[model samples]
Target chain A: MEAFHRIWKKWRHLLIYGFILGLLIISLRLLRWKYVIADQSLEIYIGIVALFFMGLGVWVAMQWFSPQSKTAEETESIPGQEPFSIDEKALERLQLTEREQEVLGLIVKGYSNLEIAQALHLSVSTIKTHVSNLYSKLEVKRRGQAIGKARKLRIVE
Target chain B: MEAFHRIWKKWRHLLIYGFILGLLIISLRLLRWKYVIADQSLEIYIGIVALFFMGLGVWVAMQWFSPQSKTAEETESIPGQEPFSIDEKALERLQLTEREQEVLGLIVKGYSNLEIAQALHLSVSTIKTHVSNLYSKLEVKRRGQAIGKARKLRIVE
Candidate 1:
């Protein structure tokens, strides 16, 4: 299924266009069957065909590319092989700025403020501001609390 | 597009069925034009219709649910939720002293030397010595690095 899905995802555009062209040929055959309609009616017939195909398109999209499909893939994933990923939800909920997140990550690893500033090539005072903001956003009073909360919440990895 | 998608996702089944039924009615009308075919051929025609619609479905799914269509919410989903466990092997390899192990765990939980000293009923100077020893054993120069290394090595939960 995974291999089939990969090929499907890669060649989907070509496949779709080819199918549409095939349908067009079929429609032309229908036109030549001595069932000649007026020009205006021909346009309407084409519209109906397009709409039907469009409905099919929407159904196909939902089946394989939706969030539900992603969830299914995740469940089928092998255990203990997936790489570490940060808790995006917690990060968003805390509304940490990119710089603050960087600072927080460093802090979690045990870097002092001066070391964090040096590593980031920022001033010590600037790192200090970011650290304070991190504390406020994380709603923690001390480094230990922040570190514990960050790990417990899986905010950093 | 997001709003339309929300509505479409909610009512897609109804929309798809209604569309298929509408096409069926149109096909019936064509059949009434005295274009009767053998039963086997009729089955083939239905198969063709089904295949065409399947193509259309695939096309539609790609357009609306593909990676390019991602919203902020989609990107913020929490991934695998694995629990923390101490790596006994790594702990053994590091050969941290009992006091150092306690200090390392506290440090991971965000404890400062003064706090760790207070908690362990040791002098601040003694806590600092234990911290230095932990840093050397962990091969880290800073608290941040130690914390990061400790977690990565799973030496502390």
Candidate 2:
């Protein structure tokens, strides 16, 4: 019973979501069987799917742009919490070039791409190329993610 | 200067992502102009867009399912936190029926429709209808989201 309780705690959310999705798909099929033709049913499916994704994307964007859990105090305390030092091996494994490394360092200091380009005597396009390449290699889509991964891997302090 | 610095800190990450997306779209258009036929170019555009969305979905799913910030201390302290009570005003604002509200409560506890149906002594189809109607009113796709909104609004503790 104790183990069942623990398992239920872990599995309930995902299971409920899966069950709801199954119900949705089953009902869509029923609608098609009763009323809609194949092509119109397909269109309805696509439209509903698109609308669902659009709402999901909006929810995600809200989470991203306005993080709920992070307090102002946490943000203010971040720089003081660490004396970050770069990890050269970690940098090498990420395949960052010397120029790209310089760009990333500037990013850690909160320099915008345009500002980094000016400082490095490179074009904005050049800076963007380096940034995107490094982001891909770091397996992160956002700047915060790249910085967080770098800090975790000891590539930056 | 201080205000500008603060604004830059807030907007920089989103700006960089937007800039990168713009570059991707421009490059796709250029590729179409220089190499591919119109029909094939359109297909490529759709393919790339789909790929981008799929990657974004993966990233969003990671953010949703694997929240990184909850500390051990927070979890341990949760029981000591203030007692959460249901907010009737919040429930009324969502315009949920009594049956729909019952389904939402079950959902918060991670109940599958089958389980909820068994407990409520209703058919699974009836439970599904109630769940779908509530989801539409809540404007969420997943059970996690419905629960999140409910907790946020104090509709469910």
Candidate 3:
């Protein structure tokens, strides 16, 4: 029953069209038997009706499938405003301790050793030690190098 | 003349369809007059022709206007592989000199002043002066801050 429903959903339009065409043929044959269309102009009448239905099909297809709607969807985005999410894989691969990660985040935010110490409630020496450990783990020499590496690796936002 | 060309370009398909439709009607009418189709089955024949043309229209519209092709185009791009272009507007806003820009680019690449001097074939003291100028102009006291600002502002590729 489920498979039958799926097939019916896919081809319902064709089935509906075929049923309507059959009904029209029956009604028209009855009309022809009662009274023929005058001047043998039945072909012209059929040609006009066929062309109208063809145009209707084209219009319906355009409504359902036009690529312009996709282009409109794509043009709505403004670049660089996307929310920042840290790269967890890189952080894990670097094997930075929790304290070290905090220090690195502050360093990327342009905080000084004393500032970081105050913010984290640690001594200046402790902050300095964390900074050095970050540099070693990230394989960089200076603070600028550490910041560059962190941003490039997406280890910090 | 240009306006006429533009209109023609936009409606050429409709005009060609109209011409073909006219020819088909003429030939169909001629066939009806020349050879009478028997048994009053003309309506069924016309219904089949109409449905065939309508299906043709739908197929043509799907081929030319389907959004799936647009989606395929969008999925072809791999994120983060786009070529980086330096922001000239931010560079001009910062009023950085050519030499300062060069030094900043090197600094962002994790270069020490001494390494930058060697790369630029300049003395260490000159590189130090350029670095200091970059720090002051960029309004950042530390090298890390300068690197961060340069990247955030897209002043360096």
Candidate 4:
């Protein structure tokens, strides 16, 4: 089970790198055997070994470079309020209550409504009222639009 | 301006390919120099070229084998539903009227309520009510939740 989990974790990287390496090996062997072969059987044997190594090399490289496996701490993120200034302006224009702004931030990050309610500790209805008020203030129609405008205005960085 | 554009269009492929080929040549020279003195330079140079050609061959192979970008027609879609289905559901649950669904779809796609109102021919307050309804139905308490739910369900795909 542990071995299976390990393989699943690294599968995407392994697949990409393995395929690239396999291509490299096959081309190298074909070229070598075509030009350098004196005996047919000998050339075929060398070609097979070269192909295997190439495939292995690619798999290793992919494992080395897979981006999805990076931990959160290693990921890049903007620090603090500097990114929120534009959003503040959008919020002001939208006349969103303070609570709505907080919720809006999570929305941009792709959280579900249930998740946001849990985070804010507010009744879903109250949250809805604030969102509605915000929609009127911003003169926008859709949630996607609200998020986009907030990002554009630096309201929810 | 036209002459410059024409020239750019005509030679773009040549310029790009040439630059890549030039880089390969330089890499080969560097690798060859690391191996030996002038006595073995010719043999080393040949080996380096072979490596460079092998690299290019592998790159071409990868391009050939990789999946092509998806087209709109190729996308799997659910029938008899708005493109943003989850947003529609959230809107319905919130008790937003027909106009609200239109506005919410636009918002999730990154439009402002005002723009949605203008497009939908509704008053700003009406748009606000719809947005509020969307927030409540999604139980998010914010415009962000509505949008996030929409995306998760492939409503925007």
Top candidate (DockQ): 3
DockQ comparisons of all candidates to the true complex: 0.21, 0.02, 0.25, 0.13
Best TM-score goes to which candidate?
Answer: 3
lDDT by residue for model 4 (B57-88), tens: 44433322221211122122323344334444
Docking class of 1: incorrect
User: How is the predicted docking of candidate 2 categorized under the CAPRI scheme?
Assistant: incorrect
Which residue segments of model 3 deviate by more than 4 Å?
A1-84, B1-84
For lDDT, candidate 1 versus 4, the one ahead is: 1
True contacts kept of each: 0.56, 0.00, 0.61, 0.28
* lDDT, candidate 2, B44-90, per-residue tens: 44334433553555454433332322321123222234555778887
What is the TM-score of each predicted model, taking all chains together? 0.44, 0.29, 0.47, 0.29
Give the lDDT of residue B133 in candidate 4. Answer: 61
Candidate 2 residue pairs that clash: A84-A157, A85-A157
The residue ranges of model 4 lying beyond 4 angstroms of the native Cα positions read A19-156, B1-14, B19-47, B50-157
Report the C-alpha displacement of residue B28, candidate 1, in angstroms: 97
Q: Residue by residue across B85-133, what tens digits does model 3's lDDT show?
A: 7888989989999999998987876666765765565678999998888
Q: Candidate 2's error at B120, in angstroms?
A: 31
**Candidate 4 DockQ, CA atoms:** 0.13
TM-score of 1: 0.44
